[model samples]
Target chain A: MGQKGSKVQITENDRAILQLKRSRDEIHKFTRRTDLLISSERLKLKEMIKENPTKCKSDPRVRFLLKRIHYQDHLLQQALEQLINLENLVSTLEFKLVETQFIKGLERGNQILKKLNKEFENVDELMDDVQMQIAYQEEVDEVLAHSIVGVNDFETEIDKELDQMEREINPQQQIEMPSVDKLPDLKQRPIASSERKEQGKKEGTEAPVLA
Target chain B: MSNQSELPPIYSFPPLYTRQPNGLIRRQQINSWIEIILQYCISQKCWRMTAEGMPVGEPDVTKQSIFNNSSIQRVVPQVFVDEIWSQMCEEGKALGVQDGKRDSSQFYILWRNLDSWASLILQWFESSGSLNQVITIYELSQGDGTADWEFHGMPEALVAHCLKPLCQRNRATLIKDERGIAVATKVV
Candidate 1:
């Protein structure tokens, strides 16, 4: 069954390429493990020698472990070669896949362009019609502008009246008023005795009424 | 140096050897034991420890084990030891090495959690400009490249465990052998 609605469709070639890459990774892992084992085995040999220098030199286990380490090292080299081959294979397959996809994409794009060109065969004529319509609209807008009354002239008259009022108010405001300036000083002055006498008289008259 | 000089003053307290009858006091006692275990492990750079207080992979740290205070002639009871390990596991300060193993006989001490360890390694990698480089698990812990690093000489297993978070986040990939043992890692 095919994968429906999936953005990336995995073909058999992709799976084969993936398998090659996985095998390459597996080989790399094996070599690394062997390398670590060799180091560990060497360490163990040193420890063994330290524990008993005389007995260790003649120990069969040491010889066996060394042989095993050597064999693993050789296997690692072989695995490395195999890994290189696998990597080359995977890269080649990947390149072929990419090239195929790119060519397919170009074919699809060319087909679409051809369809678009067929659809746009009358584009120049349509553009000419659009230009004529735009010109007609512009002519209509010009006529409408000419037929409208001059509202700007009325706005200018109002602006001129406002400016005249501002000019008149400016001079009036600039004119100094001696009386107004002296009024506050006059108010601060003490009340005259005549005014106090009047105030007392008024209070005396009100007192009799209250009685 | 003598182990007594390295021990905290509370280790000499005889009451620490016995399990407390009171629930509240027992909880405090277990907490103290957990602190001691963590501190002792950190000081000794001990990664694995048995329930009997033997430091695995570190034969030299036998004298520095925290379970016994020879001068005081007291050893923590097995029950209290189990309680301490249980509390430690619950607190995420330690983890059992073997899955589905309930005995807590052997466990790894985590002075810092895996996330912290992962970040620390990432920081080191960034500082050293070793990003996108394939490094062996042993080389990271025991190789000359990491001799000056704080996590130098750490057990490979713990280093692998610490790298799990990075792997899960796709910041690193672990390359394993045919036996499924991770031998090297590539961090980006």
Candidate 2:
């Protein structure tokens, strides 16, 4: 009783549970109606007495209504107690249903786990194969490494050549070299611009000797 | 009735009793009436009112009824009362009780709308941990369980009205009796 493709299965137990709940609801509705009737009847009786105290007190219908109200009150109380019990039963049944489903789910899970475990029974052997392959790879790596002599030397030579080429391509390297030696001299002298230019001309002529 | 003294000062004003001629002033006047009606109902805890501007349960026209300002010797005319009710209905602050009737004799004074009332009921259910529990409508409104609640003592019809939104949204289910009266509801 669901969508076109998805039909919900309603078993006898489900129908029983539904019947129980429906009875419980009926009991609840009965108690509520009884409560309303009792109160309203009481109010009517009170109003009747107020309107005509002597005649109402003597009225047989009033007595009958009072008796009926009392009987309904008793019935209401019994129904309420029954409702409580029914509700408890329904909740317990629902909880048991949930627990049953849960246990069934766990059983399914257990079966799947057992099947998976069976499939993985040779896990240790597989691990041994992997370990053997890893060892073989390590041995091959070591043999290759031993056969690769002069590779480090060639790499170092290439690095040295790269450094030299980088220095040759970068004009900032030449400027930085002289600046390191000239910084102390300039800091010590603090030469003015004009005197610094004259000193620079003299230094340019004496640059070869200093080098 | 005892809270009559707590009514606003405008209740005693004579002009409020008369429908103003000017459209803007008349609109404002109707608005003032709406506010007064809402405030007076809240203060008196009155839920339903007749078109004549008298609370439903009170049998006779009492001096304390909002329509009649006894001290001022003025009563709101029927036309003005109808106007106010229409405005209140438009604003979702009141509901006509009779089906297929434009000017129903009685209407619910919804100082709070049904949606808000639905939320309030839901909040109460959550706070009381009554979710998935069956509770009689009578108990929800008048039983000791809801003795201290704001909606306590609310009429059963109003309670049912408030639950409509919840029922539509699948938040609750209303169980009816053989007579097709909703006697209980289960909120989930």
Predicted model with the maximum TM-score: 2
Q: Model 1 lDDT vs. the true structure?
A: 0.76
The TM-score of candidate 1 is 0.48
Which digits, one per residue and each the tens of the lDDT, describe model 2 over residues B67-151?
8777768888888888888989888888887741448898888889889999998898999877765666776876656777889
Q: Please give, for residues A3-75, the per-residue lDDT of candidate 2 as tens digits.
A: 2432223345555565676687578678878998899999988887788888987898788889989999999
TM-score versus the correct structure, for each prediction:
0.48, 0.55
Per-residue lDDT tens digits of candidate 1, residues A39-80?
A: 999899788778888887689988888888889889988998
Calculate DockQ per candidate and list them: 0.02, 0.03
Best by lDDT: 2
TM-score of 2: 0.55
Q: For candidate 1, give the lDDT of residue B9.
A: 75
State the lDDT of candidate 1 residue by residue for B1-188, as single tens digits. 14555557777789988999999999998888887777777777888888777678754566444687777778887777888888888787787777514466788888888789888888888887666555567668865557787787777777888888887777777766578877667677
Model 2 misses residue B119 by how many Å? 2.4
lDDT of each prediction vs. the true structure? 0.76, 0.80
lDDT of 1 at B105: 75
